[model samples]
Structures are given as C-alpha cells and as structure tokens.
Target: MNAILTVLEIVAPVFLVGGVGFAWVKAGFEYRIQFVTRLAMTLAVPCLIFTALMKTEADLATLGTLAVAGSLGYFVIGLAAWVILRLAGLDMRTYLAPFIFGNTGNLGIPLCFFAFGQVGLEAAVVMLAVSAIWSFTIGIWMVAGKGSGGKILKEPMIAATLLGALFLWQGWETPRFLTNTLDLIGQMAIPLMLITLGVAVARLTPGRITTALWLSVVKLAICTAVGWAVGTAFGLTGAIFGVLVLELATPVAVTAYLLAEKYEADSNAVAGYVMVSTLTCVIGLPLILGFLL
Candidate 1:
C-alpha cells in the first residue's frame, strides 16, 4: 500500500544513517563519541531547537497544550515505572530512569520531521524540551541520588528553548546571516545524532539479554499506551497527536547507559536495555508511523 511505502520512506534514512555508523565502527575506524556528543549537545542541538522554535508557525495555544501534555505524560510514566520497578524488585538506581525516559532527541526528532514535516518537528521539539528538562533534573536525581536542577539551567538546550520560546512569543527573527549560520549548524544535529546512536550501540557492552528483552517489551507497551491515552485525553489531533505518541514511544536512550556508567550502577545491564529497546524500535516505530500517517 501507499501508506506502507510512505512509512518506509520516512524510516529508511534514519536506520540507514545509523547503519553507516555501525559499519564505520565495525570497520576498525575510530570515533570520538564523547567529542561528538559534546558537539551535538553543546552546539548543534541547541541551534536546532532554537531555530525550529523560532521559525515554527504552529499555534501558540497548540504548542502550550503539547508542552503540558508532554510534561504530564512523563510524570505519569515515571510514577508507573517506579511502582513497577519496586514491585518487581528491580534496582531503582539502575532501572528507574531508563524506564521513564525515552530517546526523544535522536530518533524521535528526525522521525517526526520525516513523517509530518515542519509541523511535526515543531510539536516534537516541544516534547523534546520537556523531556530534556525532566531528564536532566529528576531523571539524574533518580540515578545519582542527587538533584541536577542547577545543571538544567546551565544546559544549552534549556537556554535555547527559553530563548526560542521568547522569540516565538514576540514574533522576532534573527538577522538573515545569523539565522542562516545557525540553520547550518542546526542541520548537523539529526545526522550526527543518528550516527552517534549507532556508534554508541555498537560500543555498548550489554548483559542480561533475557531480562533486557522482557523489560524492553514492558517499556514499549506501557509507554505507547500512556502516550496514546494522554494525547487523546488532551484532545491533540493530526501531527500533534502523532508526534507526541511517537516521541513517548521511542526506545531507552543511550544516555541512560552513560548515566549508569557515570553513577556506577549496573552500566552493563542498562546497556542491555538500551540495545534491546533500540533494536525493537527499529521495527516498532515504522509500524506506529504507518498508522499515524
């Protein structure tokens, strides 16, 4: 059907770019992951967020609604995940954050753009901003038993989100040259993130594959259901509803593994979750998009 081909057109480039990175690593090439991540987070992603927000012509009310919906959806998911983890006797420090947060940045953003074009990106960006804020703050605290509220304020993405919102509210535009430069920088974000995702997965040392597989299945089911429920309850329609569900249903983030390693909490187990969940999404997302589109 035409719909199936459309979904393929949208998903093929995402996985293909990731495959390139996977092949690069397997071919004995060196990739400085930390450096690439720093570049994306500190510079490229922020620019991307800022420009997207500034240029987006989506209704302000719609953006506001999506923002609140996103925040509520994450909070509800976190609570549910916490309950499940506790009842299942899982380590909170190791599993809680991974269960709550998904890969809204790397995979979700580009998928939105491809599936629904500019409006989808706009809605997805709002969700991403909400996720970024919570992930840096509450998500970090869950992993490290320490609050990162101050650190969230220092994040470039946070600043860009605020500034971009301000620009959107005020109907302001950057100078043409500056906008073009930022746009160029922002354009690097998607490809770099997709490639980095593949590279990171390639390098991960996964353990407990059986456990990871089951947990990932649980995560997918819970997240997809919650996202659909929340978006429907909020009365989100068209691209907004689709973007919200897609972003929320993304796999466990690679950052979750990095955070576990940094906090000395079963990094290999977290890596297993990351790998299993991401591989699951390779099939899952396109199916979701097929229905959404």
Candidate 2:
C-alpha cells in the first residue's frame, strides 16, 4: 500500500499536468504548451543538473562505477533496439532515436529518490552525468548520418559536473548564496518537467499512437529484463542497484526526439516513441518495484 501510494503520489500529478495540457491543446492553446516546454528544456533542466552536481558529494570511485555501468547499459540497449527494429524492417531514422534515448533524466531521478532516498539520488546524478555526455556525443553519432560532426564539446553541464567532482574530491567550499539559488532552481525542475511532458503529450497527433505503444513496450520489457539480470548478477540489489534498474526501465527520453530533430532524422517518430514509452512506464514502474523492492 505504501509503495502504491508513493508511486501514485509521484505519477498522478504528472498525468494530471499532461491531461490539462491535452485539454489546452484541444482548445487550440498550442503555443502555450511550446512556451512551457522551452522554459523547462532551456532553464529548468539545466538548473536541475547544475544544482544536483553542486549539492552532491559523490566519490570518485563510485562515480566511475556509475559511468561505466551507465555507458554499458546504454550501449547494450541501443544495440538490441537497433537489431530488433532492423529485423522488423522499421525505418532506422524513425525508430532509432526513441530506442537510443532512455528516460534517465526526469522520471529516473525522481523515482530513484522515491525508492532509495539520498543514496539513490547520488547514483542517479552519476548516471545522469555519464548519460548526458554520451547522449550528446556518441549517442548522437550513432543516429546522425555520416559526416554530421556530432561531437560533444565542453559545455556548462560538463563543467558543473567536473567542478562538483573536484569539490567532492578536494573538499572545496561552495558559496552559500550560489548554493541556495541553485537549490531553488533545482526544485523547479521536477514539476516543470512533468508539466512539459504533459504539454508534449497534448501536442501529439493521434496518428502515431500505435507506433508509440509498440516502442514503449519494447523499451519496458527488454530494458527491465536486462537491467534486472545485470544488476542482480553484479550483486547490486540495494538502493544503488534498484536505482540503476529503474533508470534503465524508464521510457524513451525526450532528448531523443530533440536530438533527432537536430540531426535531421525522423523527429515525429521519436516524439511518438517518447510518448508511448512514458505512458507504458506508468505501469512498468510498479512492475519493476514488484520485482526489485
């Protein structure tokens, strides 16, 4: 009961926010949805990353584990997805983005907090940092056509992660004011992401639902099974293990769609994949808890 309520508590608001956005779009207020999403992607998301890094005190060894595990997890899933889609004769450009991008950023982090508290959040940050690096670099290169130059340069998120790692390693002091400000901004990330997700759902055309649902099921089933087996085999069955599994189990990431758009792939299909993946995970999350928790 407690677990159910906790999941509902986190997930219900997300559905409601999405429902509201859906209604708004149905009423022809589409522009408002775009505005909100832009705010979340440009401001709230970055703030969330910055604040997480600033406040987290992750150890170098642990961060290394997370980086290696996360990279491995992503690679395995991406390869499997590619093979499956290819076997099905699906358009690589249409389905690849959604398959390549997992929902490690928004839902994964919050679910980690719900499952394992502070330790889970730390693990989540480590995974997020590593995943972000890959998503911008190699992940892009995988989906982008040849000669796209999809290399990740030094960016704010990377800088923040490095500085945060330095602080943790060296015991450096962070200014109180900056810390407080980041905290405030970080707080906005969760709610805003939920709302943005809602807006994205609202804007989705009805034509793509079937494709999205198929992709969602693939994401949930394969990723969860593989994550569970790997995590258990490695004796990682506690908070960190649970968090990693949950992260892997999350739906197609929104960044996948954005990256598709940037790389001139089939962005619409990526969007559909994200939508279906997210909805299915609402059910998939509970199933994961049943197995792991």
Candidate achieving the largest lDDT? 1
Tell me the tens digit of each residue's lDDT in model 2 across 220-273.
888887777667666664776787788888788777777777878777877777
lDDT of each: 0.92, 0.69
Model 1 agreement with the true structure over 117-219: per-residue lDDT tens digits? 9999888888888999999999999999998988889989889999999999999999999999999999999999999999999999999888889888888
How does candidate 2 score on lDDT?
0.69
Deviation in angstroms for 19 in model 2?
Answer: 4.3
> In candidate 1, residue 32 scores what lDDT?
99
Residue 284, candidate 2: alpha-carbon lDDT: 81
Clashes of 2: 1
Q: Which stretches of candidate 2 lie over 4 Å from their true place?
A: 17-43, 146-151, 206-208
lDDT of 2 at 221: 86
**TM-score of each predicted structure versus truth:** 0.98, 0.85
Error of 1 at 243 (Å): 0.9
> Model 2 TM-score?
0.85
